[model samples]
Every structure is written in C-alpha cells, then in structure tokens.
Target: MKEVIRSADPRIAALIARQATQNRDRDQLGLDRISALLEAVGRPQDRLPPIFHVAGTNGKGSTCAFLRAALEAAGKRVHAFTSPHLVRYNERIRIAGKLIEDAQLGELMDRVLDANEELGASLFEVNTAVAFLAFSEAPADACILEVGLGGRLDATNVVEKPLVCGIASLGLDHQAFLGDTLNEVAAEKAGIAKRGVPLVTQIYPSAIAERIGEIAHDVGAIWEPRGLHWEAGVRQGKLRYRDRQGAMDLPLPRLPGKYQAMNAALAVAMLRHQSQIAIPASAYGAAMGWTQWPARLQQLHGGPLFAMLPKGSELWVDGGHNPSAAQLVADYAKRQWTDRLPLVLLFASLQSKDAAGTLRPFKGIATEVLTLPIDGHECRTPRELAHLAESMGLPARPCSSLSSAMTALAKPARVLVFGSLYMAGELLALNGPLPD
Candidate 1:
C-alpha cells in the first residue's frame, strides 16, 4: 500500500509527489530493492552507531519512544526512525535528538532518489535509506529503528548487528503480508533476531512464545523473555523491574493508558540487558516521565477539535486500528471513566482493515458512534462503518465531517476519536499539540 504523505516545503513535496509515479513493489517482500539501494549509496547502514531494533503489530513505536527518552536522559545523542508520521514526514527521522531540518532532509531525499530511481523502492524503503544515510554521516551515541511492518523483510531489518532487539505486544494485523494466524505473525516479527543479540520480548501465551523462541533459537539468538530472563510489574503506583543485573524502582510512565507501563518496562529491560550502553537507574526514572508519544490515549486541551465537544466533556484520541488495540482502548475506557458520562466514538478506518473485527470490541461499551471518512486515501465509507457499528448492537450514525458529528451530539459526553493513523494525523493537524 502507498503511504499518504504531504509536506509544507515544496522541495520535499516534489520529491514525495514523484514517489506516486514510481513502481510500488507491493507483492514482493525481499531485501533485493533496499539492499541494492543501500549499495548504490555507499552502504550507510554499515557505519551506523549501536542500534536498538524493535518490531510488533502495536506498541513498537511507543517502545522506540521510551528507548529514545531513556537514552537521551543518560546524556546520549540518539537517532531514531519510526513510521506513520502523525503530523509531518520529519517525525519519521530524528537526527541527534532533533527532527531532521528541512534543508538537510531535502538534500538527502534528492541524493537518494537520484542514486536509485531505477530500483523501484517503495516509499518506506526510501525512508529507511534516508534515515540510515543521515545517521551514518552524523555523530550520535545510539540509533533506534522501529520495524515499519513485519520484521522479516521490513526495510529497517537490514541492520545486521544491533546492540539489542525487542518485540512488543503482538496481534493479528496486515494478515495479507505477515500472516493470517497469530503464531505465523509471531514468527515473522521474531525475524529481527540476529545471532548473539538479546531478543527481549513481553510475556505471551505458551504457543505464541514457543513460536517466537523457535525462530530466535534457529538463528542463535539469546532469547530473554519477560518471565524467564527479566520481569516487571506495577505495584503501589511504582514500576519495579528486575533482571540478572539487579532491581530498581522507577516511576510509572507519565503517558496515559495502563499498557504504557509495559512499553516502558520493555525499554528498561533492553537497556539493562545490553553491555554496550551505560544507563543509570536514575535515567530509568527520568524516562518514565520524559517519554512523549502522541495520539495514544492522549487527552486534548483547548484546541479547535476540543472546542467542538460539549462543555465539560472530555476529548481523547488514539490511532489503534486492530482488534487487540481496540480491546486495549475499551479496557482503558472502562477503567478510567468512573463517572460514566456516556461514551461516544468518532471513528473511521482504511478499506483494507477488518472493520467488523475492529468494532467488535466496543459492542457493549460505546453508547453511540459517529463515523467519518478519511480524505485522500482508500477508506471505508462512513455509511459502511456506521452499518458495521449498528450491527454490533451499538447505535451509530454516519456524518459528513467531524464538525457535523460534534454538532449532532446534543448531550455532554466523553468523545473518543479513533480508528486510523491517517485520521489521527488529520485531528492533530487541525488541533494544537502537534507531535514534537
């Protein structure tokens, strides 16, 4: 699938616009294109700093955020690359703890495009090459790479030797490319495991964990799972983590949602298990508060979008599109909304997503739903989404715009906007508090 991206800078916009005309090798999933592109550009991936690679259906981006926060807290200059930018394309590549400047990004994009225009590299492949090129030429202490999709043939998986590898919460997503079954998906994600690298992961069901372990073992990776090698839990509002090295009590993540604690712990475990990085216990505590990943159960302040809601009502947004992610959002709503002011969902989804499976989790929890359309991309019609929600025993209505949806609500209620990252980006762009 072609990723939708826009830029205010014309130079960058022209470069991105040309991508639409390029050959999109969606059916093929091998390293031939990316490897060839890298070779044309002098193989910058070989000169990168000690890397921390992460992969999963969800939480991988948040895991990378925690890793960058903790690494920077330890006084290290970190370079990170994540996907599906919420606001700007610059959010995908952070060079030396700052977003890549427009001048630098334009130059790099032009150079890479000119070097390998014949390779038919996808947009993501071009992004991966640009990030590696920037990280190699710059001076940084660490580099964090988040797998764009399934790890086996993800462009970011080109790294041969990372300092450590981690996998976050896994669920069924991108079944066409990854696999239909959860175990098959787990094996594809565990493909990032390299020989002698510490493959740290969250606790999973025995069957899923066994599948992951089998792949890791086949590649000679030292599998360090949560229950066996390291463990962490939230007790009395503190995150206590223990490994073979030692134990430490750290502050819970300042980011909202109960699942963020698990993401934070995975970062701590990855840092502690590695011998290359020297991260102090104090850094872990600082990271808990320093981490800043937007649009994951993030509450809105006084913004254009928030202003549309009824007075005294709360407004929140999440970019969760899969079944597992929807369950997390539903669980959070049940736990946090003690007053029960009635739950409303402003939802939209891509055409490729399982709309019914995504809506199944909120069957009984949502009081009402208003469906909207995602502009400039292939998406499910609002009427289609409304019908899906209505079929699940939830009252739903199709609206032309979010503005109209807010106007239709006569009562004050907590409004949660979700369904797709493209919609999340549209929300953040319209409102304030853009991702930094």
Candidate 2:
C-alpha cells in the first residue's frame, strides 16, 4: 500500500506527493523490481556497515531497536531502517545515529524517485532505496534493518549478506500475504537467513521451528533457535540469556510488557553470535533502558491526546493490531496498574485485519470501548467495531471523531489508543514527542 505521509517540511511534502504518483503494489513476493531499482540508483546496499536484519510477525521492530541501542551504547555509529514511520517519513531511515534531516531526506527521495520513474517501485520500495542510498553514503559502524513485510520478498531483503539475522516472536498475522498456516509463515520469516549468518530466533512450536530450520538449511544459514543453541528468559526480575559463548543476566526492557525482555535477548544473541561487531556485555545491560520504540506500549504525557482524557486517567498508545499483539496489550493492562479507574479502550484498525478477533481478547479487560475510523485508509467503521465489541460482551459505541469521543468521555478512566500504526502516527502528530 502507498503510505500517505504528511510532513511539516515543504520539501518532504513535495517528495511524498511525487512518491504517491509512482506507488504500485506488488501482487506477488519477489525483489526483481527493487533490485533493479537499487542497481539503477547505484547498488547502495553493498556499501552498508555490518547489517543486522530482523524478521517475524511481531517483536522484530523491537529487536532491531534493541540491536541499534546496544551497538550505539558500545560506541558504534549505527544506521537503522524500520517500516511504517510513526510521525514522519524520515523516521523510516536513520543516518549515523540521527534521523535524516529534511533536506537530506528530500534530496535522497528525489534522487531515487527521479532516477527510477519507470521502475514501477512502490512507496516502501522507494523508501527502502532512499534508506540504502543514505546509509551507504553516511559514516556508520553498523546497520539495523527491520523487515517491512515477510522476509523473503521484502524490499529490505535485497541485502545479499548481513552480519546476523534474527526472527522475533512468531504469530498469526498477514495471513493474506505470507500464508494461512504457521509453518508457511515461519518459512517466510526464516527467508532472511543468509549463508554463513546466524539465524537467531525465538523458540517456536516444533513443527514451525522445523520449517524455519529447513529454510535455514536451504539457505546455508546457522540456525540458532531458542531452547536449542541459545536460551533466554525472564527470571527473578532480570533477563538472563545464555549460549555456548557465555551468559549475561541483564535488566528488563524499558518498554512495557514482559515479552520485551525476550526481544532484547534476541538482540543480545544476535550480537553474541556474530563477530563482525564488537559489543560489550555491559552494552546489553544499557540496551535494557536505552532502546526506545515509540507506540509500543508507550504512555503519553500531557499531550493533546492525553489532555482529552478525564482527569486522573492514564493514556497509553500501542500500534500492534494482531490478536496475539492484542493479548499482550490486554495482559499488560491487567498487570501494570490497579483498576482504581475503569479501563477505556479507544480503538481503530484496518479493514484487512481480523478486527473482531483482535478486539475479542480485550472484551472483559476493557470496561468500555470507543471506536473511531482510522482516517486515510480503509478501516472498520466504528459502528461495525462497536457491534463486534457488543457481541463479545463489552459495551461499545461509535463516535463521530476522536474529538467527539474526547468530548463525550468525561468519566475518569485509563484510556488506551489501540489499532494501526497510521492511527499511532496521527496521535503522535497531534500529541508531542514526535519520533525524534
């Protein structure tokens, strides 16, 4: 899908407007167009530093964040590329430990798009191209990349070789694109396993793990699934990770949810498994608090969105939309704070997602739900979502808009804004701390 990116910078806005006209979706999984486009623009991927590529249904973004944090904490200049920018399109590409400035971003986008006008590249592909061009030219010690979609045909998969590859928590998501079965999904994720690279992954069901293993073997990747070649867990309020190399009992992640520790552990294992980069064990401890992935169980503070909530109410925003992701959010809600105030779920999601299944997990956990349409995309109407919530046994009602929802929400409660990353981006723009 073409991303509708709104930028305050006029230069960036122009580039985004031009990119919109060139956007086209890839009906099948392959990298012929992107690879050609990259070659046309001067194969920038070949110039990147030690690359840390990550893929999975979930937690991959967090794993990339942890990897960047750890490498930077170890005094390395890092270049990171992640998908679905929260607040700005520039958020997708970071150059030498800082977000690419508007001038730099606009120039890069124009250069890539202008050169590949007939290449028929999508917004994500062009964005990937821009990142590679920028990262290649910039001076950085390491590169961290998160797979935009499935690993096999993702634009970022153009990387022929990387220092390490990791797969985070797997789950049922994007069945329409990847596959309906867990084994198929696992194989799709394991496609990032490059020859001679460590394919670090979370422990999966036996069948799914074996499928991933098969892919690794086919690709000649070093398969290092958890509970086999490596192990990590949350124990005694600490994240303990161990492998043949050694063990490091690190602190928990600053991000909310118990699962973040495992994501951090995946990053540590990737670092430990590879020798291209020299990362200290102490950096792993620092990454526990150093990593910051916006909208992943992130709490808002005195923002425009937070001000809408009733007094004494808390506000948290998470962009995860899958049912497994919703369960994690529900679990965090149940464990994090006492229910002194009612839990109000302010939700919206894409029409393609299993909205009913995603919302069902939070049926009893949320005291009330306020549904709103995710603007600029095909989304489940508020009435439809409200009906689903009602069928799931929770009282839900649709509002005309977020402003209207805020106006009607006068009762004190803990509010969580859930759904698509597009919604998260809108919230961040209206609120503060816009993805620096």
lDDT of 2 by residue, 70-109 (tens): 9989999999999888887788889988988888888888
The estimated TM-scores of all candidates read 0.98, 0.97
In terms of TM-score, the best-performing candidate is 1
Rate residue 434 of model 1 by lDDT: 87
- Candidate-wise lDDT, in order: 0.91, 0.87
Go through the candidates in order and give the C-alpha RMSD of each one to the true structure: 1.0, 1.3
**What overall lDDT, based on C-alpha atoms, would model 2 receive against the true structure?**
0.87
Give the runs in model 1 whose Cα sits over 4 Å from its true position.
none
